[model samples]
Target chain A: MVTLIQRILRGNPTLFFVYVILFVFFVFAASTAPQFRTVYNISNLLRQAVAFGIVGIGQTIVILSGGIDLSVGSLISLAACLTSGIMIGNPTLVFPIVFLVLGIGVLVGLTNGTLVAYLRVPPFIATLAMSAILQGSVLLYTKKPVGGVTRGFMFFANGQLGAIPFAFVFWVILLSFFLFLLRRTGLGLHVYAIGGNQEIARLSGIRVSVAKVAVYVISGFMAALTGLFLASRLGIGDPLMGQGFELESITAVLIGGTSLAGGKGGIEGTIAGVLIIALINNILNLLGVSGFWQWIIKGIVVIVVVAAYKVKE
Target chain B: MLVALFVVAGIVSPIFYRPQNIFNVLQQASALGVVSVGQTLVILSGGIDLSIASIMATSCVFAAALMAGKNSMVIPITLFCLAIGALAGFLNGIITTRRNAPPFIVTLGTALIFQGIRFVYTKGAPFGSIPSWLRFLGRGGIGFVPASVIIFLFLALVMEAILQRSAYGRKIYAVGDNKVAALYSGINVPNIILSVYALSGIFAAFGGLVLAGYLGFGDNWAGKGYELDAIAAVVVGGTSLAGGEGGMGGTVVGVLLITILSNIVLLAGLPYQFQQIVKGLVVAAAVIFYSFVKVSGERR
Candidate 1:
């Protein structure tokens, strides 16, 4: 048993850290916040994690490909603004609006991917600029809160089958799909290969540029999905709905054990990281900790997690 | 590019060179100039500091909380703010160097933590008055020159000298260009990295103090978006983001250009949103242009 535990840590230190922190956080929450382990609160926590977890999955992909996307949050905002403005509670407009929002995501992801892969712009600057552009565009779209989410659309977020939230179900499906893709597919192999060494991967004929673009497109899709669900959940279009999710998602990815340098993480780690964050957020809320200290604690977590990873390395 | 911008601005709005407007530009550039110098050093070391704006905000908040409008408290408050900034930077530096964490993530984390602490301390709205003398530093001028501008000039000169002539300057470049090579040459690479982050933190605090003085009030969000502005200046100044290939001279030019561009945008009567879009595009253009130039130069 000792050897197995030692081997597990040796093989995947990130997993060890994530799960250990997650368990400890759970225990702490259970001990400190009486309502924290209640079923309703647990459901609410899972729901809260869904949007970010989806975006975190996208971030996981981008990071795995040796790139980072700072535009996810803005992308989420843009998606929410556009879809909410266009849908306006019309059941007929739902399909078209969703498609259009997802299409915008594609265009954005392509722009970022092209800049990085073809024009050789650094991923950080490219995505950061993209973020600014998206933010600006959202502002231009509307300065006021947009409303008109149809009951059907709201159901996507609020409706649950049996004991499960629809959003959680969506999250699970996306998670399983990505997990399968990452662990059992040729595309996944290429992603890891490219991140491991682009030059070598390119020499080995792995279509590095295409893979890079594809990953960003996936990330964009995920951000859009998150935004769409967020708008529906709120039942109104908020231009700032996903204002800080980019950092949060990235934090989740990093905490999940993904390397910023790329090619060294997976979805499971990201989910663990997300759950841990959500749980802590839940506990903090239960404890009535002010929002300011929450920010401080989160920042500390990101740094400490990364530092731990660095030390382990 | 600087000259071209000046020429264009002159063509479009001769007011761009009006003495008062020029002073305004210089004054505006002054705050950014201080921040960019620190940014230049960090970029030179092949790392970036996203926490700069937060550090500035934290310093401003601390100054407000400590000085409480007392003239005599100014010196002590300022010193305390600088110390806090250095401490924040020290945390950043130690984690980044010892743990081998990427600078971007480390700084981003620090930025959030600091911003959060300031918000918690101030409860979202910061309140306090600046000391009269410090306000003079931010808003007052000595003999027709803004004191802030003069401070900026002095800082520019000193930092330029350090970057161009000092042994430590050479070490910074060496460490940035290749850490392993520097280590092989027996330089303390981690120490250099730590010092750069610390210096950046100190300057960010200094910039925050000036900004607070200029505004004559404490604002938790005073330093919002300044990080990008500083970065834009550094990039425009021709400092390679990849590190080891730029200096304060170019950053000064960059700061002037950015200040001028924003001034023009404002004068053009565009909404604030467009200003952001333009800045984003300008950064993208400058980065692409630099890469293109580097590529063609290499090929030749």
Candidate 2:
């Protein structure tokens, strides 16, 4: 037991620190707030984290690849609106719409990838433009909430598997798959190499453009999945649903010890980061703190946490 | 390119040539134009200020709440707002430089904090109005040209001259071009970066003041999307995002182009959504076009 504990402590100090913080906060919240300790609220907290976690995974990949995607939030809005608009409460149309939305997500990602890789556009500018385009398109499609999903279609987010929410379960599967890919696959190594030093990576014969493009596609696909989950949970397509998510996801990734400079972090820290945010949000809500204060707290936390990492370095 | 856009706009709408419409576009351009000037400095120094919009909003609200449409309160409040803007930028600069954190994330975090402050201060319902003198800055004109336009053009020319001739401006370029080299050359890189951010904050605040005066009221969402717009304008104008390679002259043209494009869209009676789409396409296209020109120039 001592050796096992020591191994974890030595393996990834950042990850251990994050989990420790999450645990301490969790215990503090549970002790202080009776509602927070309840199984119902705990499960609800997990549900709330699902959307952020899903998009955060994609953000992690992009950041790991030394790029950022400002378009995920807009893409989520588009996906949600498109999913419900096409479904329109029809159970029969669910699968087709899901596929369609996911396809569009991939297409958008491909465009971003091409711009960043082939055209050599800065990821910041490329993604920002893509975000604007997506946002405008969504608004043109519908300024307000439009269309609804059938009750049966809600299972994507609301269903239960044993004691676990389906969305949570889905998130775990994704987390595991990405973990395996990053830890075990050649593509993952290439991602790190590209991020660490693009010129060197190119000299080493790594398919730099392909890897860059792939990360964006992965980000896009995950954002679409988040959109689907959100649509299912809400039962309607909201044009404004995905607001603030791009920054929020980046916040999670940064807090998780993922360096914005790239090639130095993992998805495991991201999960803890997502949990920490959800926990704070839940705790603050239980404490009757207004959302405005929450925003202030969140902003401070991001700076303080990143600064702490810098201090450690 | 500016002339081409003008020709196209005139062809699309006969009213585009009207002096009244031209001045209207210039007046509308002033706020964003001012904000873009700040963004240009930061970008030139190899940093981005995502917090500018929030700073702008905070300035707008703070000015309105303090001035409260009183002519007597204008000078002090305006100075106070600019100081506050500088302080906010100083905070951004401190964290980003000292911690070596990405300006993108740091400024983003600061943006939220600033936005939260605005919300908490106003309690979600901001009240107050601009004074008439300040209103002249935003909406009033000297004959055909708007006062705001005059301020914008003057600022642009001064900034351009500074970029070309001033040692401080040259230091900004050196830091942006190569921080390590600049440091080796005995430049106080951090101080330069810090000062640049502070300048950005002041400019953003000034932009906010203009916006408030034009609107005649305090609004929570007044500067909602100006950060991106300013960035778009600066980059579209031909300032390289890579830093140290572009200048105020290009940014001025960029601001004008963006404002005119939007004006055309409005004049053509297209939906606001189309304006957004076109804006996105233009940013992307402009970047692409600039890079293409650069690549060809390099090859030659």
Candidate 3:
């Protein structure tokens, strides 16, 4: 056990550091807040973490490919609003809406990819513009919560298997798939290469543009999925549902040991990062802290963690 | 592009060309124009300040809260607000440079922090009103041109000269052009970045004050979307997001272009949604155009 721990410490200090923090915080929360230790609250926490977890996974991929996606949050808002707006609590409409939202996601991702890869627009500005466009479109559609999901759709968010939320299970499945892709695929290697050095990646014959586009596409799909799940859980689509999520997902990715500059880090630590944020939020909620404080805390945490990573370097 | 935009605006609505309306547009552009100047400086240093909007909101509210409609409190409160802005920028700079964190992430984090501070300070309901003197600075005209416009134009010219003629300005371009080269050349890269951010913050605070004066009241969302607008203007003005190229001249034109576009939209009574969509399109289109220009230029 000692040797195993030492290997992990030496190989992936960021992963180890994050896990240790998560473990300690978990223990503290469980010990101090009886509510936190309760089965219902634990399940609730997992459900809450699902949004960040799913989106952070996508964000991780994009960052690893040397780009960022500010459009994810707006995409989520559009997806959620569209899902419920079209479904209108009708079971028959659910599947169609799902495909439609996913298609829009893909299209938006493609636009972002083309702009960044082909036009050479900076990722920050490209995604930021996409975000604005989506936000405006959503606002034009509806400024308030509109439409509701069918009862069957709620299973995606609220269904459980032996006390574990179905959303958590779905997230784990997606996580496993991405982990496999990143650790054992050519595309994954190309992504890392592109992020490490775009010029070198191209010279080395990697389809850098294709890989960049693919990561963004994946990010878009994941964001759309999150929107669907959120709409199901809330039972209604809210135009403002996805606000601040872009920053939240980025914060989670950064905390998970992913470098914002790209080419280093993986999805493995993102889960812990998601949990850390969810756990912090849960503890604060249980302690009767206002939500405003969470923003301040999250901001400080991001800087401190990134700075610590810098120190390590 | 400016002339073409103006012609388009005139065709869209004759009201756009009225002297009174034109001054109104200039006044509206003043705050954003000032903020974009700061944003221009930061971007020139190869750094972005996402926190400027948050800083503006914080300073706006802080200024109003302190001034509380008292003339005697104006100078002190104004100084304090500028200090707050500088402090926020310093934090952003320190984290970005010293900690080796990306400016994008650092500014984003500080944006959240400053926003949270604003919320905490006001408990979500900001109060207080701008004094008459400041209000005049925002709204009152010195004959044909608005005072705010004059301030904006004067600052732009001064900054233009500084960028064109000063050692500090040359250092900014040097640092942005190539950090390692700048370091080897004995330029203090980190200090340059730090001071640039501080200057950006000070400008943002001044812009916030102008905005507060115009509105005559404190608002938590005072500069909510100004960061994007500032960026859009800066980029549209021909400043490269990659850093080291572009100037205040292009920025001024960009600011005027954006302001006029919005003014035309307002004159035509278009919905707010259209304005946002157009803003997004403008940013994307400008960047794409610039990239093509750069690529073709390189080919030559």
Per-candidate Cα lDDT values, in order, are 0.88, 0.90, 0.90
Highest lDDT, which number?
Answer: 3
Per-candidate TM vs. native?
0.96, 0.98, 0.98
Model 1: runs farther than 4 Å from truth?
A: A1-13, A311-313, B11-15
Candidate 2 lDDT, A1-313, residue by residue in tens: 9998789989988888888988998899989999997878988899889989999999999999999999999999999999999899988898899999999889988999999999889898899889988999999999999999999889888888888888899899999999999989999999899889899999999999999999999999999998998999899889989988898898888779887878889899999999988888899999999988887998898778667667322
* Top candidate, metric TM-score: 3
In CAPRI terms, model 1 is classed as medium
With a 3 Å backbone cut-off (N, CA, C), the pairs that clash in candidate 2 are none
Candidate 1 chain B: minimum summed lDDT over ten consecutive residues — where?
A: B267-276
| TM-scores of chain A, one for each prediction | 0.95, 0.96, 0.97
Local lDDT at A165 for model 2: 89
Judge candidate 3 against the unseen true structure and give its global Cα lDDT, from 0 to 1: 0.90
Off by over 4 Å in 3: A311-313
Candidate 2 residues lying further than 4 Å off, grouped into runs, are: A311-313
Error of 3 at B273 (Å): 1.7
Chain A TM-score, prediction 2: 0.96
